[model samples]
Target: MPTVTWSRLNEDRRAAVVAAAEAEFAAHGFSQGSLNVIARRAGVAKGSLFQYFADKRDLYAHITDVGSQRVRCYMEDQIRVLDPTRPFFAFLTDLLDVWVAYFAEHPRERSLHAAASFEVDTDTRVSVRAVIHRHYLEVLRPLVRDARGRGDLRPDADTDALLSLLLMILPHLALAPYVRGMDPVLGLDELSPDQPALVVRRYVAVLAAAFAPQPLTTATPGGAQSHG
Candidate 1:
């Protein structure tokens, strides 16, 4: 959390500090990010950063918290406008699209997110996961429950289990395109521009099958449809 001194800073100064810290942390993970560089970029003395945050870790945590909140709010806003009655798989794809769009519009946040995944300390990582899990339980639980009621999921499906599955893979769906080595077959360098979309469609199809009441006659792009 920022100290009272941070709130006293003018809006522009606050923005500059956050922007500089975001860029630094995005380029280098927390372990390697430099407060000196952040202060320099923000046009504040290095000593003054301590006035805003207790320490380097505090600054990093603050940046991550802000970035995560922005993503959650953006997702909620997009989900609010979506038609809840859309076909289950199509609806999931649209939600994923919202994530892709958010990252596209906020590349710095995206990079910071990636860096945080690799480098956050155990406590911070646990805290981040808890926040995400709460959001999933709040926003996604109702959707899956409704899907089951509509027969989109198997009669015996466990809503919490399905939600957990989605939660596990959701980060991959959002970040795979931006990260190297995310695809097993493609390894580090084979992620062509189109391959990312193809991978996403395949994931959607697999998820649809995992929870569907029956085998799908038609699957999303890059997925094989069942034929009898």
Candidate 2:
């Protein structure tokens, strides 16, 4: 949360602080981000940052909130392109492609977001994770409803379950660079962006299989139900 002092700063000064902080957090993550460097980059005295933010934790929360707002804007743009008439797998694949591509097109933004997944302080993580999760569900509902109505998904499909799975996979879209840095031997980090896209395409197949309706059968009059 930004303090009243932070909100009262002139827009230029405000942007300077925000930009400097974003760069630091993007480059080094929260635990490693340097207040001293942030203040110097903003051309403010180190103590001035405390005036706008209670501490590093507050600053991280503000940054995470701003990131979520950016994600909201991106998803708003994406909602227009969603089409229930498209094949469900194709639509889903394209949608995820656009999501991963958004961050791909902006490396700094991607890094800032990926920062959230790292060693986070527990106090901030709970609230921050909840806010982003709420946004994910908000953006998912209408498109899912439309898909169901258009017969792209089964009527019994659990939107919650599906969304949970999708959101879990969505973070992995940004994990390539992080994974590469953490341990190159794991091999997932070595893939080109297109390779992950193909892997996720296979995941879409699994999701489609999971959501597809099962055939209903009845016991034959003469005998027993066959397990095979």
Candidate 3:
């Protein structure tokens, strides 16, 4: 085994505590989760947790920050190498694939996000929304603009609207498996591993078809100068 430094071990312990707190909150929600239980599960003393985080709310915020960074890093690593000249749908397909893979591997992180959504404070909601929006828009708006400039999307298409649509769709798709258990109408459990990609492809295809620039067509023969 590789030797670890004391600082590295401390960082690992802090991460463990955060992960344990996330799991506890995900299982019981913020109001009911116990810090002592989290510390025990993380194999760190309760005082160590307090040393790292001032309170439950502070720890929860840190967990959310970590989760946000995890998702941002995942998307950045995948999208960084994408060919800018490809059709916008190609990039979207890659995005959907990355999202599916990430959610599959980090179901607990997804659960933590879902649990955090139920917190009662308006300020907390606003802060979380700002963080999410900043991360998404920083990466997504430029891609949307590039697609429009390349004639893959209509020039009139609103980047913010498209981004919002994608944001709405991805989480719904990611959580569909669990949602289907509560309401069979969702039918997400019916999807195989490949189905997420297929579904995203179809959705993007339809959107692109609707929004792609239309070339002007001239009237043929004796027709009165009609245009498409």
- Which candidate comes out best when scored by TM-score? 2
TM of each candidate vs. truth: 0.76, 0.79, 0.76
Off by over 4 Å in 1: 127-138, 186-189, 215-228
The C-alpha RMSD in Å for every predicted model, in order, reads 6.2, 4.1, 5.2
lDDT at 23, model 3: 86
Residue 228's lDDT within candidate 2 is: 25
Candidate 2 colliding pairs: none
Q: List the residue pairs that clash in candidate 3.
A: none
Summarize candidate 1's per-residue lDDT along 33-148 as a digit string, tens digits.
88889999999999999999887667766777777777778788887777766777788887877776677677876786677667657765655555556666787888888888
Q: Candidate 3's residue-wise lDDT over 1-228, tens digit each? A: 112331356677767877787789888766567888998999988877656655555566666777778888877888877665688887788777777777778878678666655556665555555656667688788888888888888878766778888777766656664444532443456866666677777778777766777667888788866567
lDDT of 2 by residue, 1-228 (tens): 789999999999988888898899888887788999999999999999999988777787787778778877876778566764576667888888777677777777778767777746776566456666767777777767777777777778987788889778777765663456643542456766467577667778889888755555567668866432
The regions of model 2 sitting more than 4 angstroms off are 82-87, 181-187, 214-228
